[model samples]
Target chain A: MNAFVQLDLTPLLIGVLAAIACALPGNFLLLRRQALIGDAISHVVLPGIVVAFLVTGTITTWPMMLGAGGAAIVAVVLIEAVRRLGRIEPGAAMGVVFTAMFAAGVLLLEQTDTSGVHIDVEHALYGSLESLIWLSADGWGSLLDPVALAGLPPELPRMAAAAALIALLTGVFWRPLKLSTFDEGFAATLGLPVAAISLGLVVAAAVAAVAAFDAVGSIIVIAMFICPPAAARLMTNRLERQVAWSVAFATLSAVLGYVLAGWGPLWLGGTHAVSAAGMIATVSGVILALACLLGPHRARVGAAREA
Target chain B: MDTGFWQAFLAALALQAGYNSALVAVGAGLLGAAAGAGGTFLFLRKRALVSDAVAHATLPGIGIAFILMVMLGGEGRSLPGLLLGSAVSATVGLFLVEWIARRTRLPEDAAIGAVLSVFFGFGIVLLTVIQTMSSGRQAGLESFLLGSTAGMLYADAVTIAVGGALCVGVVLLLRRPMTIVSFDPDWAAASGVSVRGVDLAIMGLVMAVTVIGLKIVGLILVVALLIIPPVTARFWTERTERVVWIAGALGGAAGYLGAALSASAPDLPTGPLIVLVSFGLFMLSLLLAPVRGVAAALWRHRRFQHDVHRRQGLLALARREAIFDRLTLKVLRREGLIRPDGVETPDGAAQAAKVLRDEKRWDVARRVYRDETIAGRYDGLTSIEAVLTRDEIAELDRRLGPPVSVGPRIAGAVP
Candidate 1:
């Protein structure tokens, strides 16, 4: 009973919030054909986090977020520059910039004296989701009590704020985003600030990424950014329904993945839980795979139905 | 800075002194060349990022192969066994990308991203399982993620060498068919080349190279080895054959130098260093390569614009007076096209006659040709140096009779 009470729910809540936040802006990226920008930004943020840690001598929230946001902007700019200047394909350009940035992050981490810091290089790569715990909880009721809310992990509120920000931004810019994504030339002809809207989307993705990085890490964040939105895209051609489906899929994966990570090992006769973040990513992937194989709107299924 | 460091660096560089490093370097170099050559076709086909998906997909195979080997009570890290597993998984990944693109409404980029992230996620799950296993030997499997060449044995090097050689051999044997398919699969198919067969062959070669490259550069950075060299080579040449050869050379050099440097500095990982080195080479090629490089192209464009302006100035002067502009005359004299006294030398007479003839043709074309035809021929007229065919000149003559004397009449102008 005590173990159950002591069991923290923050990780699950944070995962859900982060997953939803990532998926919201991720739909625009998918429609824009920039689905992999999330992957690129995830990698490029490592150096940002590490540099922030190095500069501030602490792994605080704002600095890391600021650093990551700055890094994301730099990554977008650099990717654009490489694409335009080298006349290289966007994917290859992205591959070059992100890999180099990630390499630089690794090298920097190795060089810096970060022994005393709570965040290590391994933590940056795979994340430290296991460490997130709320020990002050006495029972499930305490989680609902405002008194016990102070005991909640800071990552929860951080992720919640980020989710709100992303949701707000997506709502505000929904029309321009949809217009530009569907037809950039038309949007430009209409004198819509297509470039600004696109940059705003990138910035929104960056914020969600930074917010999620503390809880789920970059790999899972990247998976969330593409897999749910992509699966949703398969399920529907309509953008509104797609966004709803993406959020639902993301939430489903988060809850199910967290449960599986915590309890699946016990079912399999192991004494310990696996990585919740990795499990989340794996679940989203499984959902995407299933969607690919069995979605009603999938071309294979549609073809079979017609036949 | 110290003698010990200097000695170690020298020993690292001297292949004879460090046999293990030499073997690893040679193996990596061979892998690099094979990937580079194979990657040229992939790049030309505009499927460069497919290699990324293929590379990430190999991780799960390695994990699965290790688990199977452990379950079978054999050593899980057997080179051939692991590589075979990697090859199968990479091929499946390639097939999935193709399948998704073909059977679904999703674009190729989304398909690739889906496969890459999902496969990697599954691999991480498998890795987590491997970590939880009671077996202690599973520790070495993590090296496949980031790559570590320090532990490569001579047998491992030989395996890479043999595999790389086979991939290169296949690429060389089928270069012509591969080029045809890459450039124009429809035409290749129409011309009796089995486009499907060639595509499968190239995909097979990419899978082989990617799997073999996994040990040296790891999964994440292996695609860089496949892409950067070929992309850099593209900045230097337009011919597929030259691109392939240059890409191979650049990949080999990057792999060789990167391995040597990493061997000297044991702290740095070989995979990222190799990528960084190749990236450096790519940057240099992007900036400095002769034809398509940014700097060279910019200079050529500027020079072309300057020539256009000079020719326009000369035409303006010739239109106003029988003599050339002073600046044009100075340039022409420097090129031995004119005398210092501003009279047309034989070469100058030919150039001036050509320019005057172009000006007269412009006037005749304006009156005789319709606006649409003149617009169609606008590029030719603006170039001024375009050599008109005899038929075109005769057609112009028939329409306008002799060339109109619009510009200052040169003595030896073509009539």
Candidate 2:
């Protein structure tokens, strides 16, 4: 495509891939009745980063990912332990563990040496969608080997990975996940190890969250996890249908967010390109708002007419 | 630890005093506790997380307030203006959440979550715009995200404390009506409790708490203080009065501790500290409280099981005939249900027998046997049938009283 069109395509591509990555894991979370666990793990993973930085003296993605994933596991375990102790409800356990872990993470981050960290806080917030422009379709793997197409975009692999992950999850555990999500006790009665399935979903969510964190900042990561599936859930009860709608919504939002951020500048009078992550979030928000308005359940309208 | 640290610590204290920190902290804590107490009822009703949505909605109100401040040529960062703006927006948010849940097929949790995130996003957008347009006049808006009690003044405390007290006092005054509405609104309505009025009052109370609490616990932790304490306190007592008092105490303690800890350290965020401390207290209460406490319950249940096992063992080993352990065996006794001797004495035995015969076990047996009757019909008359004889029935009645009046007995029934 032309440079004009290509500029718009970058963010949208990232947004779509990010959204897909986020939404795929989110569907399982929503199904497993641990939708908020994503929110919890996102906060808890901070201490992981701090611990990683303190030990390794670096801010590489791999170390951060390991730290975050470990912390997420700790949070998951804490929630389960608290619930099994029988005093705290699952939600309360989740709320307590995540908040405590988040607070601890913040405290740790405060003490860490920031000098060696190449990425500044603002850069972290802005993200590096610009990096997506030069990478090849096969990604950085080919870059180290001096592949001829090293200069191409890397969106294809990212999108492909997200699609593959979603397919694998849906294919292997679709029936069991749906059964457990709808009724855990019944699923247990059916001899399903609901706990194992739930833990598996949480791990998948953590991996997806870490993967997408590069595309979208931590804040938007939550919006992506919650918004698309949430909006899809509003219109449908069928789990398969909800997943379909979620992917469709994510794709549309990503494409639209990319285009808007890219071109809104030429028409809208702003010099800075609209942020890809911000635009995607805004699109998700818009879609949800529209759904709320158009959805059959307007209490006021229904109440008034009924009365 | 060092002179510099001490200096920083002292400076922090000075700033706190300069802003009337003690008064505000106490006021907010008291108000937060009261509101938290009121929150307990809602928690029991399983609507604890709704407050989180209300808290999130307050952000847009702050944004609007800042805009209004700009329009009115006042400092947008002023506490009163911010508080007022948040209250209005948070109230709207609460109503919208309820409306959405009621009107749509969305579950309450989803509705709350959806509203909270969306409103928060809108708030962010507003904040981003204000920052860009006003050249950072709205810098203070970010502090509200996590809360900043560092700048709390006497007036802020007084407003929240007094308002919170009034709301809580009203809740106490209407406790009877409120409880009735919560547990059984239909029955309460029949008894002249205005369910609608009670609901309105409670919602209004929740709103007041949310507004005042925004300063101390901020948006996110506000729900924690409201929910965690009440839930934690629930483990301590079955009595509503005790639960409220304990929850209030726990919440107040959390607020106070949070303030002190934040004050002790210069860089720490007060809101997170308060929530963290509150969670600690909640966990402790959940584990160790008297009746409902998890550990306590487990202890009681274990002891109870041991006693039961011992009693059962004693009975089984009794004289091998119709004997029982003596009344003073101590371990073999349970109130009402068991005696020292495993077998009841004539009087106690009669009472126990009466209760046993009252059960419809024979009727159940008859039903079970009827289905099998066509196959053989108890050719030798099943052993259980012998227990149902007229003579045995007469003897049982003489020993005990007549069996509890159920339906008429059938002669030569299936058994």
Candidate 3:
């Protein structure tokens, strides 16, 4: 029992699932020119969390997740309305909506301390990954069947849920999502239900955002969403290749980040072990930096070569 | 809201009793407008978003300044020392962003975003360290997070005023050259305009305004102030000169309003509020402008539809008359394919042609038709005795394609 508990594979498993879930939808967000929507949504979700905490008197995951999701949808709606009614450009509208929502959230938190729910600005920004303390028995059953994965432990359930959601979303909207991202006007002319596809993409991103936020804070969630897609873009300009590379990169970062965080303390003589989320961000950033520097399809190099 | 606004206004006036805050606000607004106006050219040049990068890119420099202040044991009480450090760090950051771009394959936007995030993260890390080290009094660093007019001493205001005046002076002196560069960089270069120098000058103006406005608007809202007002002003006019003037005014108004709000309500963050207000103004311009507003476009579209239908009705009536009269048609036939007796007829031809004939031309045509022919159906010719047959009018319609795509076939279609 001591060995089983000490192994502490639960967080690592959850991290993997979260990263996969995020990277899947994140690919479309990056492609659709809504690259910063994740950042926008992350900030906008603050007020939602505040409201949820105020109502529930606790910082359990579900209320905060639901609240964050609702706020994100509202943000998307607000951005659209602002663009239509005011003729403001997309980027400017997004900036205004997110900043306003974030400010409102901050103001609310400052005005009310609530019943000491412990969901403060720190939690809003840097998340409480340590909350993955319980591993559900039902979670294990769904994750593993008798013959399918009998050897796997109960921790696999969380990973299975994350993987299943990501896989299902990716499978369902793969074609239309790509078409909408490439040319929205053309997609509409083809009688594609553009509104439904766009909504699906947003919902997918919100789900992915919640899943990733559970492991890494909102601040780093943006980096996770943007960095992998950006790095993949650097490696290959083609959309298909970018999605493939992004998923692979995200999975690798999760495993490596968890391993480093779990074991590096033993070697370095410290309890703080470099934050796994930070490490993941740092690694992803480093990968992007490398790709930017060395990638062949770079504009300047391509220009120089053509010249 | 009204009473709150008035109270806020009075409190702001009181805060500016010595006129120091007022002076700083004016200086910042002037400098910000100059930066923003210059941004118009940059924005038009498709590099508006670079301002966003430059704003965040300054963070590392601010962090380095904080570190230096700590090293010199002047952390909390030294404004001059901090400013000097920040200036050096900011220039370094600018240099690094350019260098990285030169050495890499990153597109400009992605490169800008990356540089911004990395430097901002570095600043956050430095700030965290600074917080940890301070013991007796927390570093009064929260001011930088959302600007503090409480620190706007007279000297700071003067420094900003000088910067603003210098920016405006330089822009005036180089206005012609800058316009040439903006309108046609290649042409300016070919005509010996020193394109590189003009670009460097514009960049210098951007840096000066950013540095000056940093104290008034804070880091995050500085870019918005610099870009949004100029973007908003663009909707009201087509001329570049008017755009510059209006944009400058908008920026100044926003700065004044923001300062007043901040002074009155001490609790509200000034930068974000100012940005929100500016965006509100931008929305107003988009909706209500007479010439280019969305409302105007919709109105013009309706008017155009009405005019087209009215003209089509006149042409249809004229075509009916041409089909019956042979001698009157022979007179029309000589007027081209609408020949009265033996003119050619295209399958789908309108009879009435609304040509832009001058009075003299109409008088001459009327005289020619007086004794030419007075035969079959000529009722449609009563308005203007000179007749035009269906085929001739259809030929004219074929030459004029409607500007916008109407629902199906254009009503002005020859048929």
**Interface DockQ of each model:** 0.49, 0.29, 0.22
Q: How well is each residue in B1-415 modelled by candidate 2, as lDDT tens digits?
A: 7786566446544445335566655665776578668877677556767777788788889888987887788767777888899989888878877876776555566666666665665676566556654535545677676666766666777777787778678777877777777767799899998888888777777777887777766775677777778777777777777777888788877776666556665566777777778778877876787776778878988876665544443333321234334432344345433455454444444433333343224444444445554224332222333545576445534654434432223222213
Residue ranges of candidate 3 with Cα displaced over 4 Å: A1-20, A31-34, A46-164, A178-199, A210-217, A236-241, A251-280, A295-307, B2-5, B10-24, B76-106, B134-137, B140-143, B148-176, B305-415
lDDT of 3 by residue, B331-391 (tens): 3444454433443345213333332221222344444445555322233224332455655
Instruction: List model 1's recovered fraction of native interface contacts, to 2 decimals.
Output: 0.45
Model 1 compared with the native: what TM-score?
0.87
> Model 2, residue B133: what's the lDDT?
48
**How does residue B415 of candidate 2 score in lDDT?**
32
User: Which DockQ-derived CAPRI band holds candidate 1?
Assistant: medium
Candidate 1: stretches off by over 4 Å: A1-6, A118-121, A141-151, A300-307, B1-11, B308-361, B369-385, B388-415
Worst 10 residues of 2 chain B by lDDT: B405-414
lDDT of 3: 0.62
Poorest stretch of ten by lDDT in candidate 3 chain B: B352-361
- Candidates by DockQ, descending order: 1, 2, 3
Quote the positional error of residue A209 for candidate 3 in Å: 3.6
DockQ of 1: 0.49
Per-residue lDDT, model 1, residue A79, is 85
Report lDDT per candidate.
0.81, 0.66, 0.62
